[model samples]
Target: MTETAEQAVQFVAMARKSFPALSSMRGSGGPAAAAVRSAAPMASHFLRRRGEDLLMKAVQVETEAGLANVREIAKVEGLDMVFFAPVELAASAPRGQEAGLLLALETAEAEVKRAKKLLGGMLVPGRSAEMMFAAGYDLVCTTSDVILVRAAAENIVREAKPPATGPKGGLVRFVTSGREAKFARNDETLVTRLKKSRQARALGALVRLGSAAAAELVAASGFEVVVLDHSRGAEDLLGAVALVHAASRAGAHSLMRVPALSQAHLRRALQVGVEGIILPGVESAEEAHALVELCLYPSRNLRDDSHAAEARLKNQPFRRMDFSFAPPLVEFYGQRVAEFSRRQGEALLIAAQVDSPEGAAHIREIVKVEGIDMIFVDAMRLSGADVERIETAAKKHHRLLGGLLVPGCHVEDMYRAGYKLVCAASDHGLLAEGAKACLKAERPVE
Candidate 1:
């Protein structure tokens, strides 16, 4: 046999030696004597009489049938088996099977205990690693290929992206004393600033260009706000957090357009501390109210002090500052929850899109909804008359009018039409256009 295989066999033999055969247990004294007596039944569950050869094998399972087979083998041998059932397998198993397999493993674990045999459960990396450890298994398996690859990828991404530093969230105009310092920006928060600044005409950037580097570069380019566009592209919570932090560290305000009006997406965006959320395709006052409720909380109508928001703080990237949000082994997360809650729509901008005819039709009612701060018209989708109606409604309700202004749409016309926060071009649009221009320049026409 190869050296590694020889070592594995030697190790298995050593393990087997610890539990003496049932016939010899009476002679083995001390703690082991008692252990052997209790563990003898376990030996029978694993070993089978195959003429002259004995097989020592471990069960590595991801399915119910596989686990059941191991359980049956252990039962037949009367010696407990040290089975390896990875947590990832249990989690990815069919919905009901995931729970069922875990329970079955737990049941097999109990049988092992009864027979005084060995049972060690293996677990993969994820939120479940801690859960399985806390479940009181005898041996906790180390990281496997899944975890190694995940960790490696995360490390590479972190290395490629710049770490967040300095002040985070909102704008800060620092003032200094002889030894100490304090400062303030506009009394209006980012949302309020965008809402009330009619003549501000602050240059803003639409950050559809993903990656932490892109976000950081855009934030440093002197934009008043970085609107993270997820409506047209793919974005995850972690990426959004990175963008938000990068924007904040670069002294720019952060906003996000969620994939949709999803509670999970809204909560994650809020927890990551986006200064605003632009809800797309809002059609009615009721939908506006619901969106607003999801955006704001501690209000009379809606609240979510759930762990979903608080748990994001558990990760370092989502922490409020350099200091930890979670206290050392304490259950009181109220303070942390309150910290997240304070960033709600009232404190941040709650803008909605009047993109379709249905949405434009209810502009007046939608604008009147409490907590709705900005009404953005999708210039591409809405007609000139429709844009006019939305603009009129926004003006009447004293809400900010904002939208995406394409090439043909005059920026001055948008401003004249009372659109305060206008995105003339997005990161993707700029890059695509620049590439096309470069190609045309390279092959000049005669």
Candidate 2:
């Protein structure tokens, strides 16, 4: 089997453990779903190959004759039949995006049902994941890798930390800063939006597992930001690029939570289009300052400006979809990129995770460091008093505060306690809870 086929097998093995009765799970044959979260360059590749490869290969190859041959081979090989629809053909279609998708869905559904094979809709768009499952898709693979790893990482962190007291362990009211209020009225960033409208309390989904398709789906749900948690999830440079691109395509801002304060991690994340980076385990003002420097270009130190720096600095400007310039304006764009690079520390947000007592003690000083956008405390790592100290320091420094809100922790209380950014839940948490609810409702004890 090909490497892609092997991944499908792994997915099948993983799925069977959850639903023993499931006979088999198939992989998506189309490139879009196959490539959605696969790597960063996949989208550009697909776009460039629109005329020949996408149409001829995807649409034509997934025909009845081709599928029948595959079905026979699968039976001979003792494998289950998995049908892939030509969803990628939607982009190459003569019709518009929506019309292409509707046509492909109708055609693929019929073909897969006729052959008695499991329909595999790779990279289901928008809220179509829910609808596909409801339409009786045996198994739907929304995303994989980083998302799952992050879920496990978060669970481990939660388990290792101190448990909360009774529900609503510490309650405090949160107020937006004057600067935040001003930004809300002017900037399009997630922070600004949340501040502008109290009712616009933005909810974000953390992609712990490296599923760009899943991230895209979450983005479709109207989240202001989608966080790719590298601190707890299994992700490398390529995976981060894919997740960030996918989130942006789905109209959501992307944030990456790095494991530590490192230049390599920060530089790569910025290059790949993350709007912000969350630095976990920040314990001192010096460390916080260093983290900010890592994210910024042209720090106080003297360094030669190389051709590579120019190219990478230009990467940020290319992030905007409509960023086009005239041939004569090339020099102007270059100057803009150069200036943007110097002041990037001010433009890009820096978030620090304070999960240790040492970090809590230095919270005031850490917040004083410029570019430290928000401070998130792990509820398990800090007690009521510890939280109070952090809150007091935040007020003094005039910085925004944030935290992780697990179950039984009252959201209102956290807000009252002055948490501007509270990650109430994650993708894996929601999935597990939803599954348990389904099982409980359908399979009650006698």
Highest lDDT against the true fold, candidate: 1
lDDT of each: 0.61, 0.57
lDDT of 1 by residue, 404-439 (tens): 874587878888878788876667776788899999
Task: Give the Cα error of residue 74 in candidate 1, in Å.
Answer: 29
Name the top TM-score candidate: 1
Mind sharing the TM-score for model 2?
0.49
User: Residue 70 of model 1: what lDDT?
Assistant: 51
Question: What is the TM-score of candidate 1?
Answer: 0.52
Task: Give candidate 1's error at residue 207 in angstroms.
Answer: 2.2
Tens digits of per-residue lDDT, candidate 2, 1-446, equal 21133444454444334432111223335665456536654553444334222221111223333333443332222134454433222212221122344454555566545656555544444435778777656666565454466568769966655445735434533467653563344455655554455444445678786877778877887766788888888878687767877887777877778887754456556666576778888899999877766665332111233344445434431222111111111111223333444334334566778888889888878888876777767758777777788888876776667767745777777777666766766667666888999999999699
RMSD values, in order shown: 17.2, 22.6
